[model samples]
Target: MRFLLIVFMGGGLGSIARYLVNKWVGGTLTSVYPYGTFLVNIIGCFLIGFLIFFTQRAGASTIFWRLFLVTGFCGGFTTFSSFTFENVELIGNQQLLLFFVYATGSVVLGLLATYLGILAARNI
Candidate 1:
């Protein structure tokens, strides 16, 4: 029950953050389709990788923080849930090409975006 609560809280935070990013970025990003989503995914990816190393070095989060940051925050922030749902709809409609485009585009652009985010953060 406690674990569940942790995840729920974290997810809520993640989801809200994701929403804010989307709202801010909107269609005006003017670089890359779904640039906001791409940006979020990239940021999420960078954090995940960084967390991997940091957690390993000084021990990881307590169960609660893990659930909050990893499950909730990262989960909410990225919106792969929505991404999956949309992808499923595309696939169901037999829009295989679009599905592939969405999938590959999401991955490639997402990765680049994340790397950029990490690079910027590191430099800063």
Candidate 2:
């Protein structure tokens, strides 16, 4: 019950943060690109990687933090479904070039961000 509550709280916070980021990015960029989802996914990936490494290196029981931050928060924050849907829409609208760029860039950048996060955690 305690664990569930912790995850629930973290997820709620993450969802709210995601919503705010989407609103801000959408308002700033008037384009067909899914910048909001891309940003959140990459950020979430980095955060998960960082937290995982930091917690592991600390040599402590971080099950609660992992569940809250990684499983709950990051899970709520990242929008894989939206990303896929946007890609489909792009394809249906014949935006193949944009679709490919967005998809490829998100994947490549997300991986890079995760790696950077791991490095950052290790250094800290």
Candidate 3:
């Protein structure tokens, strides 16, 4: 029950952060590429990687923190559904090249970002 409350709080904060980022990035960008979701996904992946690495290296043994940050926060921060819907819309609009680029870029870059984050945390 206590763990659930912590996760709930972390999720709420993560959701607000995501919404703000979307408003800031999405509102400013004039492209149909869904930059907001792309950025959020990559950032969330990076954060998860960093947190995992850092916690393990630092010997932080707390399920509450893990659940709060990884399962709750990062889960809420990233939007796979939005990314897929944007891709579908792009394809429907016949923007094949952009769709391909966006889809591939998100996956490749997201993974890279996570790896980089893990490396960074380990090195630090």
Model 2 residue-pair collision total: 0
Candidate 2 on 1-124: residue-level lDDT in tens?
9989888888888899899999999999978989998898878767776766787886668888877886678767875634655687799899999999999999999999999999999999
Worst 10 residues of 2 by lDDT: 79-88
> What's model 3's overall lDDT?
0.80
The lDDT of each candidate is: 0.76, 0.82, 0.80
Highest lDDT: which candidate?
A: 2
- As for model 2, its CA RMSD to the true structure in angstroms is 16.6
Candidate 2 deviant stretches above 4 angstroms: 79-124
Residue-level lDDT of model 3, residues 41-102, one tens digit each, is 87886787676566667665767687788667876787563466568779989999999999
Please identify model 1 stretches exceeding 4 Å from their true place.
Answer: 27-32, 79-124
Candidate 2, residue 14: how far the Cα is off, in Å: 0.8
